[model samples]
Target chain A: MQLTDYEKQMLGGENGPAVARAMDLLVRYGEALGAERLVETRNVAGAFNASTPSIRSMAEDGFDRVYSELNLDSDDVVDIPHMAVPTCQLITGIDIENHALQGADPGLVDMQKDGERFFGQRGINMMCTCTPYQVGNVPVRGEHLAWMESSAVIYANSVLGARTNVEGKESTGAAGLTGRIPYWGLHLPENRLADRLIDVQVPVEDMAGWGVLGYFTGLQVEEAQPALNGISATPTLWELKHFGAAAASSGGVEIYHIPGVTPEAPTLEAAFGGNPMPDPIVFGERERVATWERLQSAEDRSVDFIMLGCPHNSIEQMSRVAELLEGRKVHADVALWVHTPRALAEVSKRSGYTDIIREAGGVVMSDTCPAISRRLPKGVRVIATDSAKQAHYLPAIAGVDGWFGSLEHCIDAAITGKWRGGP
Target chain B: MPDGQSTSKIVMRGRGVVPGKARAEALVTRQTISGWGGINEREGSVIELRHELRGQSFAGKVLVFPGAKGSSGWSAYFHMCRLNGTAPAAMIFTRMTTKMALGAVVTRVPAITDLDGDPFEMIETGDLVEVDADEGIVTITKHET
Candidate 1:
């Protein structure tokens, strides 16, 4: 891999020991990916908190030890420095406001608080949500970014027309300190072209339809980029967010194109970028029903828990949830949690949506979700969610059955404590 | 019945990823593994529901698989596996991705990929294997039936 003089200087420890270690990890990671060079990136989002139980013992020593071993992949502990580029924190394992409801230990909450203070002082913005683009870090088209979170990576690459592969925690850590990442995968212009094509037979309407279509796309495309055709409706940020998140969860899908819907492809002819588009795989009603059925892991009708957001809801989605629960009371057996970003959570509270939902026996959560934290209401045996990503993961992660449906079905389940959803 | 199986030795060549050497029993799976919610690093076990390797521990064994899937938390979770002393003895995979490469780098285990022969066909669970990632070579000793 080629390195500039400035990079060489950083590797030589001219900036500091932590920067040197960060550069070394970048080199090692870059070489492993067959990356020919390092790309400069001022936009970075990474997973850097000492939130989980696995990091509990490491936190006892110092945050530096945790950063040295976990972030830099280095054995030596070095004095950390301020980030050389713009960086923000992603979703962590614990929600500070609802840790008790999440069954999280108080000590772990303190550990995460200490971690925030330590990294926050060094200029790492605590955005603390997966949807950084939804907040304020929207990168321009063709811009290079080093970001973690598979859902956000797919969104940036596909919807925003920005370029980034699915970077990991360690690589993002190095990029935060040195403003560099491996120039491979989606960074190159030629690699972003779509090769797999799928024709949508049914109306890809609403978040639920987009979620099912996204799930099917992941299974078919796997790691490859896909192009969608035969769309009848234009999707907003909500549908696309759920679509990307669902695709990333079922398989390792980084980027996909919807031809007219996505930014890069204005037409079907332009989507392939001169690459040969494969024979169209029809995603008819049969496929949609099968996809929806696969997401349903629950056999029983009783739903004790209802989780509304996976990629974290937008303000509109929060309002929609509030509007649905305005006159109803949550069933005595059901516990409901609606998640949004902290920045948006404030708006939800101020907008009266939070109070309405809370009065109806639902909690508005921020900063984390159940799947990420591996926590739920005590003894949750059956779960229902409107998110395809969350429904696919919560059952597997929490050892409980799950039901996937529309937002109305999820709200009905929360109010009646019954599973009324079907394919 | 235990004596009825063939004990054949097979040798294959691939690219060295992590640059080290390790020898251990091979635990093979064709399914791609996820790191975040799909695994329990503290216990070194696959926890993803409906995964074929669910409840199986890769600790002190050669983990042969397709590659990584799901979250960008792949490397961090595998890195925690190394710190907890629950990582696989060696990593021999078939596919390459940013997630797989950085994961192997941070796990700091002997890793090899892109072999000339199909690793899934030639390797199976409980097979004694040697991974010399520095030289990009793997030797498999088939186990008893």
Candidate 2:
């Protein structure tokens, strides 16, 4: 890999120890990917998922230390969130909140606190939550990038067509400091192509259906991008969020083209950029049903837990849920949770969605999800949700009788405290 | 470079991410790792829940998978693996998740995505394999005593 003069000077400690240290980390990152050289990143997006006290303390301390050591400019504002959110549920252990706050096994609260400290010192704008794209930081196509999530990476690559390597937490910190990344993969046009093809002939109407289809297509496509055709439904930006999230979770897709949506391809041939699709797969009812089955547990019984917001709930999502539960109440036996960033939580509070959801017997929490905090009420024998991505992972995270259905089914379970299958 | 090994064998057909070449042992995962707590940046080991390959090192292996499971943090976990010297030699996405793709790109490990067969069915833990991310081809050579 070639290094520029500035890079060499930084690596050689000609730029001082702090720049050298920061460059040194980036250089390792560059070498790991065999990047020929590093390119400067612009409009960089920062994200971190530290959920342990010790690690969080280190991260928080490191951010401050690195900032002061380098004397970074304030204009290089960071986009880190003030707290952490649960990314998964605990399979073992008791007392969800207690486990997250004061467990023998390091808890997530400390991680949140430490992250807050680090970004706080730098005056980094920390918008805690995985789905930063939905919040206005959405990068335009062909933008150089850095982010710290699988779904976001996939979304950035596939949905947004922005170039970013699925960077780690420290990578974001280093990139944030140095403002550089090894340009390759998704950044390159050659890497984003329709290596495979899918003819979507199903009637995918809602987010749930989109989630199921995405999971199915990802399962079928696995590691390749597919040029989709015959998509009867023109998914809204909101629906595409679920599709992109599920697609990335089910497979590793850097880019995908919906006939009318996205830029690279206006037509199937254009999506492939004139390249022939070697294999064309058809997705229909059976495929969707199979994917639904794979994402859900076969068990049929009363459900005790229901969760939403895998990518962190947006204010609009909260408002929608609020509308859904205006006159309803969550099941007495079921515990429902909605994950969001504290910043958005404040907005939800002012918007009255918080009160409505809370009145409906669900808690609107921040800095954690059932997955990351390992905080799910004990003995949740059955769990149901509207997210296919969440349903797919919940079994491994928490041993609940899990089921994946529409929002109605999830809300119904929340209302009746029983497992109800969807049609 | 091993004797009697074919370099262009099709391992599995899932999604494809990076375009390069790498060879090493295969790390198979059933429950994908979470990006947040799934990887220890300092240690570079899989630290997520119920993962069959949990606590296992990712040093120079032809990592195989159905795909990443949770959190946008998935890409970061793999990125940490590269930074801390525990990176996989090559990665085969049995399926591609956005995080996995970004992780592959950030780590710059030779990653071959979009396999021709089910990697989970064909490749098992401890299998010797070679991946060509450029051609989207993965070759597995059965190790003989």
lDDT string, candidate 2, A133-155, tens digits: 76557778887886655677767
Could you give me the TM-score of model 2 versus the true structure?
0.74
Q: Cα lDDT for residue B137, model 1?
A: 95
What C-alpha lDDT values do all the predictions have? 0.92, 0.65
CA lDDT, candidate 2, residue B73: 56
Give the number of the best model, judged by TM-score.
1
What is the Cα-based lDDT of residue A71 in candidate 2?
A: 21
| Residue A214 local lDDT, model 2 | 79
What shift in Å separates residue A334 of candidate 1 from its native position after superposition? 0.7
DockQ, per-model, please? 0.83, 0.20
> What stretches of model 2 exceed 4 Å from their correct place?
A53-111, B1-145
